[model samples]
Target chain A: MRKDSRGFKIAFIILLSVLVVVCFLLGNAKGTIEIGVKRIFEVIMNDDGSTQRMIIWNIRLPRMILAALVGVNLALSGAILQGVMNNPLADPGIIGISSGAGLFGIAILVIFPQHQQFVTIAAFFGAMLAAFIIYLLAWKGGIQPIRIILAGVAVSALFGAGISGTLVFYSDRVYGALTFMNGSLSARSWPEVQTILPYTIAGIILVMIFAQKLNILILGDDVARGIGLNVEATRLSFTALAALLAASAVSVIGLLGFVGLIVPHSVRLIIGNDYKYMFPATALFGAVLVMLSDTFARTVLSPTEIPVGIVMAVLGAPFFLYLLRR
Target chain B: MKNDIIMEVKGLSVSYKDNKVIDCIDLAIEKGKIYCIIGPNGCGKTTLIRTMSRSIKPQEGHVFLSGSNIFKLKTKNVAKKMAVLYQSNATLSDATVRELVQYGRFAYKEWWKGSYEEDTKIVDWALEKTRLTDFQKRKVNTLSGGERQRAWIAMAIAQKPEILLLDEPTTYLDISHQLEIMELIERLNKEEGITIVMVLHDINHAARYADELIVMKDHKIFKKGDPWTILESDVLKSVFRVEAQITKDMDTNKPIFYAKKVI
Candidate 1:
């Protein structure tokens, strides 16, 4: 937001552009029909009925875009929650939002397998419900961050158990549910992207518009009120917005863990806590982080793809531990 | 409903769970005066101030700021008339003095719009008033406790409000830093005609700096008058449960108290 940080901004922009290009080229572009960057561009320019064009157009491109969008949603959601809750460690998953969405996702996967298209909608409701429950539980006098977190831990464990019990009884769908729970992007197509696109865009627009308020909100609720912020209304709306974003991501990605947690924390280290810069920066950085990690997950084993959640946890856990020590 | 009344509360009562923290309190604060509320730890001083600022909602009654019901008005509109510095300031992760002060101008600007030149000028003026002009770019966390308190006050000052509410503005500071904050507050009241209502822990500081004092006992106003008129040993004993020597300062002609023991 200041002139002094112009160089860093420009550098990060360039870095993000390069990473976007790399992600587009490498996403699912492996195995027997590996498409080169030039070939990928040619296919994008002219889509034939060939398998190569199909891989680039119908499969990899959509997957890549969806990954990036999910990253944007999750990171922005985390950034806003961290600000609203006034806690750096807050993320959608840690606060039980992702798990709440995950419960609905598993329900759809198991019970309403025929109505798989309803997963995103169900997840949104579930996420909002979780947020509402957390808010309600934390409402002894007013919502305290510690209480929300404690309630979150309790609620998350509840949802986690629900997911486990559902899977345990319905062991027939365990493979699909396990992959989804581990947060894989395998076999993901344009429909999944279409499902979350409008919500993701809407969430981003809302966050960008309200980013300045988020900056004030980080100053504590009472201080925010002093500055004329309708603290309760603003916080509720932002929480709903955050829940919507995280739920959208969860429905498609199946409870991806650390994109929300790591991206905002890392971006704050680069840019300060001013949400004007921090939100956008978190968006770009989160997209790149997820895209790159997804690429690694796909190519590292070459056809035996690992889950992106595993990749993120491998990368994020140490960073989290280090931050904790600091 | 006096014309000079800037902020007035009528029959205000606030309850937390089952306990009534502030009970049926009525107060009318005249414009351009420094009023301090002093009592023991749990006498609801903070709650009363918070209710007046609309930070705490009363169970029954309304707070009128500039003749408008504070809770009924839009938050930004109420903010234009009064700004409050709550006791526990939210810990900012990384905020420069300038950026923190810029938040004070939030009510003036649209969400999408940048700070106008006028806003910038006011922010600069606020920083200068708090003697933090040179430290504008310094992160607030990096400042000393006294300096951080000044930053918070500067942020409030940037609101350009007629009334400023401070809850224990000098709780954690050393004696000299306490004096520094009290002096700054006194100067604001005198020079800018800012009506200040603060909850103070120290009886002497309240008596020395405040033009008027509201002594609270058992969730009610025990007494309200000029510090010189009300600073008696019996009032101190009943209100704060302390045995004290009340003396007049020859220089300031204000009442000063020396607490010998907590009775």
Candidate 2:
């Protein structure tokens, strides 16, 4: 009999928004050369191209922005996947989508070095292919969550093997692929930020605009159809959009893990599954989570960094188990 | 003649995995009446109802709504004319009853604008009509079976349809809840003038609520008539394989049946 209180959801969103700002600032301040807010503002307000300014402007700022964008992409994609498949466990990272993107992304980088510019497009195609194969394998007239997850695990393993085989064959290029395979945020600058921003904005807008469809979809396909939805068409469009969002994020971050699973699931656990609020809430929470997790990844053993994907998995797998048991 | 026949099913047949579930069936639905299709389990009663609501695509033949092919019309247009309620739905378990009912206004939503005061009024009206106004704020899964059924009915009626289709609407309810649902269906037909087409497992409930009874057996219609003529002992034993004694309800003067051993 628990009610979905609008005030509670709006207030929680406000709290998450506040957390996003806090995460950004924490990420900005904590590092080898820790700078106070006043010093940071001083550099921003008056840039004389000093060492601190370079550290803030060239390194920390862009990476933080990229982290936030990845957060938005993964969280929104996860939200859509949960709706499209009607399963809570449908994360891009866990469901072979990231593996698909990684395999295609690495292939573009190492195998076809000349056409490396089409890496993002190749990654998207791979992700779509992975999604289609999973759907084909999992479908017994309808998408069951367990079947999809099992199929995803198999596809993910297969793609992981493909990535491994590619690296061994092209062993000379393994150096660059290491950070990518672990989804690190080290040394990424403005170019990475620029690569991910447009996709994030596009994914967010589309998710908001189609939020109502997700709500209708939760009512089951037959009822959704009876209520005038082109049920099959809606499912296809949303699934593709989910894959595209996840692929674009992976194209930039290269196999980043579990912002999808953790952020959206936690948000829904708080706000419930009305996508109108859940999408935006999940987006904001995602920004906070990744920025914070990246900060933790960088600072937990300062000067010696851990990959943010490791941080996310250490946090996510346990939470996933908790949900499964519940 | 065509105008009075609000929906016409012509040579409609549906198959599942190459096994025919619904044989070619033809029936005409007159406007502003309650019709019930009754049969044993797996007799294609559910399939026929689904086909009529366009939930299932027939393998052959056409279903015409308002003398136009239903398949040709836009989905929203069909939804606006007819609304179907199912016995079970893949509901977001946490959704509030009011929120679920509000989704029924989906067809009226434009590309730009979402909702209006008019929609709110209709939603509230639906909640009131279903006697679920008090429970509208509560989660759907937390409600009792009867209350949940009413909530679904509220959502369906909120579509503001001229025709309503329900597939085994009271199959899972207790006897008291079943009576409540039948009375509610009767009210929706009599008060709102909504043409009702429902599939029911309970013959007595159908005999009481249905103005016309369509008895189905083995994917084909066994008999079709007014309940008084259709609920006789011979038809019941033939269609249901039961020795059913027909009786009259003392208060409502409707035909009721008591069935014993199967044939």
Lowest-scoring 10 consecutive residues by lDDT in candidate 1 chain A? A1-10
lDDT of each: 0.85, 0.87
lDDT of 2 at A37: 78
Evaluate candidate 1 and give its CAPRI docking class based on DockQ.
medium
Compare the candidates by lDDT and give the number of the best one.
2
Report the interface RMSD that candidate 1 achieves against the true structure, in angstroms.
Answer: 1.2
Contacts from the true interface found in each model, as a fraction, amount to 0.75, 0.72
TM-score of each: 0.94, 0.96
DockQ of each: 0.73, 0.71
Per-residue lDDT of model 2, residues B13-131, tens digit only: 99998889899999989999999999888999888988888888899999999998998898888988899998777575478899889988889898978668989999999999999
